[model samples]
Target: MVGIIGYGVYIPRYRIKTVDIADVWGDDGEAVAQGLGVFEKSLPGPDEDVATISAEAARNAVKYAKIDPKEIGAVYIGSESHPYAVKPTGTIVAEAIGCSENMTCADFEFACKAGTAAVQTCMGLVTSKMVKYGLAIGADTAQGRPGDALEYSAAAGGAAYVIGEEDPVATIEATSSVTTDTPDFWRREGEDFPSHGARFTGEPAYFRHVEQGATNLFKKMGTSVDDYDYFVFHMPNGKFPVAMGKVLGVPKEKLEDSLVVRHIGNTYSGSSMVGLARVLDIAKPGSRIFMVSYGSGAGSDAFSIRVEDEIQSHRGEVPTVDDYIARKTYVSYSVYAKYRRTIKA
Candidate 1:
């Protein structure tokens, strides 16, 4: 079966609370936090960036997979916050994880869903027998203009998955996607931060694409919401996915464990993939997981996955998602500004 052989996630150690951010701007921290359903967001250290985060996550995946990196024939890193405009982050990741020189490598950017796009690419390659394994990653050091609405949720982190046909931790049963030419969000060529259409990002962009993607996947798989044991969606904030759950009739318990955004904020490309990792961290064999990722531009990729018995043996080898969430140090807004480079000398 072409599925996830192993998965790993990396969240930055630093965090900045919503209240701290709001305090600087003279907004009501309690009101802002409650509205967005976000308490705090992650912050990349001055020495950290997309490349570093991707490499760390990739190494963890390699450890979890217990496979020779030389066997991985493809590597793809997806993010909007790649440190370079002209270079590929995939090469750095492949080399960092000790992959063979004979593999193909590239980067992807489709906003938050780019990582799932890379995962789909790996699925295709593995299913075709073109490669024994493929490494897919989603990571970002997301940018938000100081005091903008996005500053409260735009955060940094990453996740990596190793896809192969062997003893997989989770088997992918089906996948589908939906796309539209919606102008809900964008960052211009020279712009440091993205611009959004505010509420337009909700109805026409994220919700429309994600709902359609899930609907299409259900149709393709001949299943419904109740068939899955868990559900995960791209969490631009804690509120969007919960609201989506209500719209889709998913029970609160089924979607609760994946709401990492409540603490880490939005990890952009890493959003849904990291949520999936959290679900997989706790899921038992035979548990079914339904996941959908949304990207502004815009599009969504949905997948139906079933946990395998192999997960029990491999999941404990590395730190769980909760471990990363618990290992954090809060940063002041001024320190955060400096780390994020929001303040000029």
Candidate 2:
């Protein structure tokens, strides 16, 4: 009975087309878009940050759970973009969400999979009776160096999950994680943007870690990809998930609805959590879900979720992920640059 009691996501309405970047750099827009399988990416408004996004998602999760916020005994936020170098984003989120003063809170950074790591921690706390209800958030204002390959895909957004035993929307069937010390991406102290290992970010990094996590989950739970109705992977871009799905024998249709990285880019820690929220929005009462998340440091977390009956009542109650997706307003590269603060006046 221990699982997600509620979930919510916050994605900015602003977007810049992938072709816009190629246009600026005199690269092939069509080829770039087709190659990455990402056409656009969400951009945070000047007022938005990891804290604001986390607060919105946490508030929505509380509302969806229909519980007193004071009952929240723990809050964990996963993100690399904590506003302060030393302050904890979890406490800010907890205070904004109205969680109790004596709450267990911390911020996590494991690259993109940080959000799922928070989820795993909350699950443990709630199931262990250490917390009545725990809040787990994955949010990021991810950035890419201008003209870099990641510029088109590194973007901003986040999602939150409330986990408990009371009236869950889904139940966790199984979970597994695999990690290695491989360095495919890094941003040094005081570095403005991250540097990647170029061709190394793919083969031995993202794909290898994600595939290993998925394969381990399959063997651990004795469940096949065919057992799930939908599948979601850490979408650094549209291409990676599809390519990994193929390697794992998952059909395109099963991965389609959750393949949102094509539209929103990578939200870093929020990447896969947002995808899971989208899947839950349309999942049937008995549908099964498969999710695997990858962080650039070379690690992946995989989980199996079975939709609960309570999901039917809440599916249309909140702002649908589709609504956010369709309500986008396009922005030019110059405006996008200004919004991201990458361009000095």
Candidate 3:
């Protein structure tokens, strides 16, 4: 079956509380936390970058898959905060995971959904027999302006999926996407931080795309939301996923396991996929999962996956997402600014 053979996630150890960012902006941290349903955001060390995060996650996937890295025929990394403007972060990740020169590699950027887009591409390669395995990674050291609303949620993390025709932990039943030219968020050349359309990023972009993507996938699969045992939606904030879940008729119990955004903030490209990873960690064999992701270009990708007995097989090779989430070291706003390089002096 063409699906996810293995998956791994990496979250940085540092964190900044919503109160910390609100303290800097003279806004009410409690109200901000209550509004967004996010308490803290994971932060990268000064030494970390997207490439490093991608490599670490891919290594864990290789371990989980128990496959030789050289057997992986392609590598795709999706992120908006790629370290080099022109260099492909995928190449760095491939080499780090011990992939050969013969493997194809590229980077993807469509905001948060780029990661899942990579997943779909990998599925195609494996299904076509062009590759024994393909690695798709959604990683980002996401950026938020000094005082913007995003500062409380934009965070650093990533996940890697090894897609192949065998040893799948979850097999894909169907996938679909919906897109439009919605400019809810953008950062022009050389801008250190991205700009957004405020409330514009919500109704017209995130909500619309995710709803349409999920609805179309359900129709294509000839099933309704009630058929899936679990659901994960792109979480730019904690509330959005929950809101969209209710809109799609999925109950809170189906969404509770996927709601890590409340703790780790939004990992951008890694957002929904990471949420799916959390669900897979605890899901029972034969469980069905529905996932949808949103990006600000904007667009959404939806997928139906069936959990296999294989998920219980390799998930213990590395620390779980919850393991990483529990191992945090909080930093003050000043230290966060320094590590994120918002201040030079």
Candidate with maximal lDDT:
1
lDDT of 1 at 3: 96
Backbone-clash count (model 3) = 0
lDDT of 1 by residue, 148-224 (tens): 99999999999999999999999999899998899899998879999999999999999999999998999998999
Instruction: Write model 3 residue lDDT over 1-345, tens digit each, in one string.
Output: 898888899999999999989988999999999999999999999999999999999999899999999999999999999999998999888888889899899999999989999999999999889999999999999999988889999999999999998879899989999989999999999999999999999899998999999989988999997799999999999999889987888989999999999999999999998899999889998999999989898999999999998888786798788998999999999999999988996
Weakest 10 consecutive residues, lDDT, candidate 2? Answer: 312-321
Model 2 stretches with alpha carbons more than 4 Å out:
none
Q: State TM-scores per candidate.
A: 0.99, 0.98, 0.99
Worst 10 residues of 3 by lDDT: 310-319
The per-prediction CA RMSD against the true structure, in angstroms, equals 0.7, 0.9, 0.7
Per-model C-alpha lDDT, please?
Answer: 0.95, 0.90, 0.93
Clashes within 3 Å, all models in order: 0, 0, 0
